[model samples]
Target: MEVREIALGAGESYELRLTGRGARGYVWTWQVTGNADAVSVSEAAPPPAQTLPGAPLERAYVVRGRSPGGRARIRFAQIRPPYPQEAPYDEFVLEVEVTAATGGP
Candidate 1:
C-alpha cells in the first residue's frame, strides 16, 4: 500500500486523485485523527510517561467508494484539513494502495 503525507492548515484544502483497477464496489475513506501521544508501547512502567485522550479533537473528510468488478477512478477536491492544535492533529492519509493483483508471465 502507498501512503501520502500532506500538510495543510485550517480551512485549507487538498485535491486527492485516485485511479486504479480492482473489483468494483470497494469502500474507502479518508480519515483524520488527533493523537497527543501514541500508546505504541504495550507494557507500562510505574511512570507511564504522558497520555492523551481518545477523542478526535477535530475531523472532516469525504470519500467515494469503488464498484466491484470494475475500474475505480475519481477526483476529490472537497477536503478541509483540521487544526487540532491541542492534540497535534497530524493527519495520516493512509489508503489501501493495492488490495490485490493477478499474477502474470
Candidate 2:
C-alpha cells in the first residue's frame, strides 16, 4: 500500500475507498493516529462476504474535518484473524490537512 495526501476545508468531510481480496480473508481496518478529535473516521459499511473465491471487496471510510489548521494521520491495515506473529499483511497511511473554510463571494 502507498501513502496518500489530501486536503479538506474545516467542517468538511470526505469518503475514502480501499480495496482488498475478500477471498483471501484479508480485510481493511483503520484508525486515526493523531488529531482524533479534529478529524473523525468511521466505516461507511461492512465488507461484503464473498460468494465466490478471488472476489474483490471495497471498504469505505468517512473522514470529517472538525476544525481548521489541523492534521490527521490515519493508518489502514489489512489483516486476518488470530493475529500475525510477524509483520502485518499490508499497511498504509493517509495524511490529511484541514484548512479554514473559504467564504463564497
Candidate 3:
C-alpha cells in the first residue's frame, strides 16, 4: 500500500488518477474514511477506449474539500469482483487536511 498526504482549502478540489488492467476485469474502487464529511469524492469522466487487449486503463476521480478544519482519508484498491476475499493487486491511500479558505480583497 502507498500513502500520500495533501492539503486543500475549503471548496478546493483535486483530480486523482489510477491505472489498472481494465481489459482483464480489474477495476479500481475507493472509499472515504476518517472525517468523511470533510471531503467529497466523485468519479470523473471515463478514459478513452483502448483497442489493444490487456492494455492498461486509467480512471480519474475528483476529490473536493467540503469543510474547514477537518481531515479525511481516501483509500483505493484495485481488484476483480467475485474475489472479495482475495487481496487487491494494488492499493493507495490519501490523507487530506482541509483548511479554511483565505479572504480576498
Candidate 4:
C-alpha cells in the first residue's frame, strides 16, 4: 500500500488518476475513512470509446472537500469481483486535509 497527503479548500476538489488492468476484470474501488463527512468522492464519466482488451484502463476519481477544518482518508484497492475474500492486487491511501476557503469575491 502507498500513502499520500493532499490539501484542499472547502468546496474545492482534486482529481486522482488510477490505472489498472480492467481488461482482465480488475477494477478500482475506494472507501472514505476518518472524517468522511469532510470529503466526497465520485468517479468521472468514462470515455466514449470502449477499452481494448489486454490494454490498461484509466479511471479518474474526483475528491471534493465538503467541510472545512477536517481530515479524511480515502483508501483505494484494485481487485477482481466475486472474490471478496481474496487480497487486493494493489492499494493506495490518500490523506486529505480540508481547510477554509481563501480569498474573497
Candidate 5:
C-alpha cells in the first residue's frame, strides 16, 4: 500500500486527490484526532476512483474538525478486487495532519 501524509494550517481545508490507473475502484477510511473540537475540519467531495477491470464503485466521506491548537490525522484505505484472477488497480493510503495553533491558547 502507498502512503502519503498531509499537513493543515489553522482554518485551512484540504482535498485528497487520487490518480493513476487500474480497476475494482477504491475503498477509503479516515479518522480525525485532536484536542480541538469536531468543527475544525470541512471535507468536500471525495476524489474520483480509477476505473478497474470489474465493477464501477464510488465512496466518499467528510472529516470532523477540531478546536484551536489541536491536530488531526486522517487515514485512507484502498479497496481491492475480489477474484484471485483479477488485475489489481494501484493501491493507496494517506494520512492528513492538521498543525496546532502557533501561540498558546
Candidate 6:
C-alpha cells in the first residue's frame, strides 16, 4: 500500500514511510518539487536492513509544514544508479496539505 494524500498543521512535521526492494542497489529517493515556501523535506535516515535478497526496506521521508494554505508534493523514485538515461524502476507520489494551526479562542 501507498499514501496518496495527507494533512498537517503549520510548523508541524510528518514522516512518510515508503517501502521498496533495496538489496539489489535499487534505492528509493524523493524529490520535492512544489510548495517550497510552505514546506521542507528531508531524508531522516537510512532504510531498514533486510534479512534476505529481494526483501523490502522502509525509507523515512521527513516533511515539515512551514505555513498554511499550501500543498507539498513529493515524488519517490527507485533508482538503480550509474545510469542517468535509464528510467526508474518504480515511482510514487505523496501529496501534503498544510493547514493553519489552531489557536486559543
Q: Identify the candidate with maximal TM-score.
A: 4
Candidate 3 lDDT tens digits, 1-105: 889999989989989888888888888988999999999999898877655777788889899999999999999999999788889999999999999976779
Per-candidate TM-score against the hidden true structure: 0.28, 0.81, 0.93, 0.93, 0.42, 0.79
Model 6 residue-pair collision total: 0
RMSD of each: 17.9, 2.2, 1.2, 1.2, 6.8, 2.6
- Model 5, 18-73: lDDT tens digits are 44222434443344444435234344564355544564444434443344445444
Given candidate 6, what's the lDDT at residue 13? 86
> What is the TM-score ranking, best to worst?
4, 3, 2, 6, 5, 1
The parts of candidate 1 lying over 4 Å away from their true place are 20-23, 35-105
Q: Could you give candidate 4's per-residue lDDT for residues 1-105 as a string of tens digits?
A: 889999999989999988887878888999999999999999998844776778897888999998998899999999999788889989989999999987688
Off by over 4 Å in 5: 1-6, 20-25, 34-43, 46-66, 80-105
lDDT of each: 0.27, 0.80, 0.90, 0.91, 0.46, 0.80
Please give, for residues 29-82, the per-residue lDDT of candidate 2 as tens digits. Answer: 777866766688888978655446676777798888877888889998888755
For lDDT, candidate 1 versus 6, the one ahead is 6
Candidate order (lDDT): 4, 3, 2, 6, 5, 1
Using lDDT, give the best candidate's number. 4
TM-score of 3: 0.93
- The candidate, 5 or 6, that scores higher on TM-score is 6
lDDT value, residue 77 of candidate 1: 21
After superposing candidate 6 on the true structure, give the runs of residues whose Cα lies further than 4 Å from its correct spot: 1-3, 48-50
For candidate 4, the per-residue lDDT at 41 reads 96
Better of 1 and 3 by TM-score: 3
lDDT of 3 at 97: 98
Candidate 6 versus truth, CA RMSD in Å, comes to 2.6
What is the clash tally of candidate 1? 9
